[model samples]
Target: MSAPSTDLTQEKQRFELLSQEFENSQKDYSKFIAARQQLEAQLQENKIVQDEFALLKSDAKIYKLTGPVLLPQDKAEATLNVDKRLEFIRGEIKRAETQIADCQKSLESKREELLTLRMKIQGV
Candidate 1:
């Protein structure tokens, strides 16, 4: 009958809308994942930089505090530069970690929303 046809059409439209929403969510999720990956890579690079800086600091400390007085002025300047760079890298790592956390949270929320939508669509 016409009533059944109308219901079918409405249901079809609802399904189409849901499908579109799902696709959009999927795209958003992918973007979140990419952002997380970028943050992680930045964090790793910062860690490496931090490690190198730490090694430079240790070397400078050994030369200044324990070794002979042959340490040159340039070495002292380089040590200060390394210290500043280490601090900057540490700050960058912290910011990247926060960004990664935010991306993870967004991804989780999107996944949950997608799951709920699927369940609703399935009449579960």
Candidate 2:
């Protein structure tokens, strides 16, 4: 009913909202980290494949595993496919990194806001 009580109630509501936001940011950050890790792993695997391809002779036979069958494939085609996949994976990695950085910044900002709100609530 009083002004101080009303201010305190508002502060408490703000704190609750901020807490929820912080939790959501944390979850997003975690998901981005996992995605980045998986992308890194894929990048590593693709690099290895590229290296192996480099060592193979131009006339070397290539077989692509399609479902349960090993279908004969042209070495040049396979190499091109791997190169394209590497490019795609690299782009995805960059995107994931950006998302991760953004999420991290958001989390930090939310944490500071939440801390400040908590202090304000306690003071009230």
Candidate 3:
């Protein structure tokens, strides 16, 4: 029932909440890293596909599979499809990288806040 005991209890609660928030931010950082890595991998694969497409003969045959049927496709169309896919992948990679950067910034802020909270708790 003492004022000091009540203040101590409140401080402890705040410290615990900050700790949980910091932990969640760390998890978000990990997820962002993984997503960025996956996007980079996809980008690399698409680049390789573009390179291989460039090496094909002018009259090379292209086909698209549609449920067990190989539908013939024009070389120009195939090239366009690859180009579009590469463009999309590049955009996704950029978006993922931006998200990773944002996540890092947030994590840094949370870390600073957690440090400040810890200091306050200690002072209390």
Candidate 4:
């Protein structure tokens, strides 16, 4: 009947919309994963630098590369800067992790919605 046909058509439209949404969520999830990975790498590198600082003597000459110039830096100051950088990187990593987790949840929910919509379309 025409009523059944109408229901089928509506369900198909809904399925299409859900499919698009799921695709978009997948893209967002990928982006979040990339960002989280980059943040983790940065955190690891900073931790390595922090460890290196421990091997250096207090009076060791340290230089900071600022663009094209190597500026002399006091060891204490450099260590402090590295410590602050590590803290900031750790905070950023936590934030990225949170975003990744939230995006993963969104992706899972959208996937479920798409599957349900597919079933409805088939039934119609």
Q: How many backbone clashes are present in model 2?
A: 0
Please give, for residues 1-124, the per-residue lDDT of candidate 1 as tens digits. Answer: 8996776676666667756765775676576567656656665765675466566643454233336555544455655755676576566657656765665676566567656656655667
Off by over 4 Å in 4: none
Q: What does candidate 2's lDDT look like per residue over 36-65, in tens digits?
A: 999999999999999999999999999999
Model 1 RMSD in Å is 8.4
Worst 10 residues of 2 by lDDT: 115-124
Model 3 spans with C-alpha error above 4 angstroms: none
Q: lDDT (0-100) at residue 86 of candidate 3?
A: 79
**TM-score for model 3?**
0.84
TM-score of 1: 0.51
> Which scores better on lDDT, 1 or 2?
2
Of models 2 and 4, which has the larger TM-score? Answer: 2
State which candidate has the highest TM-score: 2
Which candidate, 1 or 4, would have the higher lDDT against the true structure? 4
lDDT value for candidate 2? Answer: 0.92
Question: Model 3 over residues 1-124: C-alpha lDDT tens digits?
Answer: 6997888788788878878887887888788788878877887887887788799997989888889999998888888987998788788878878887887888788788777777876884
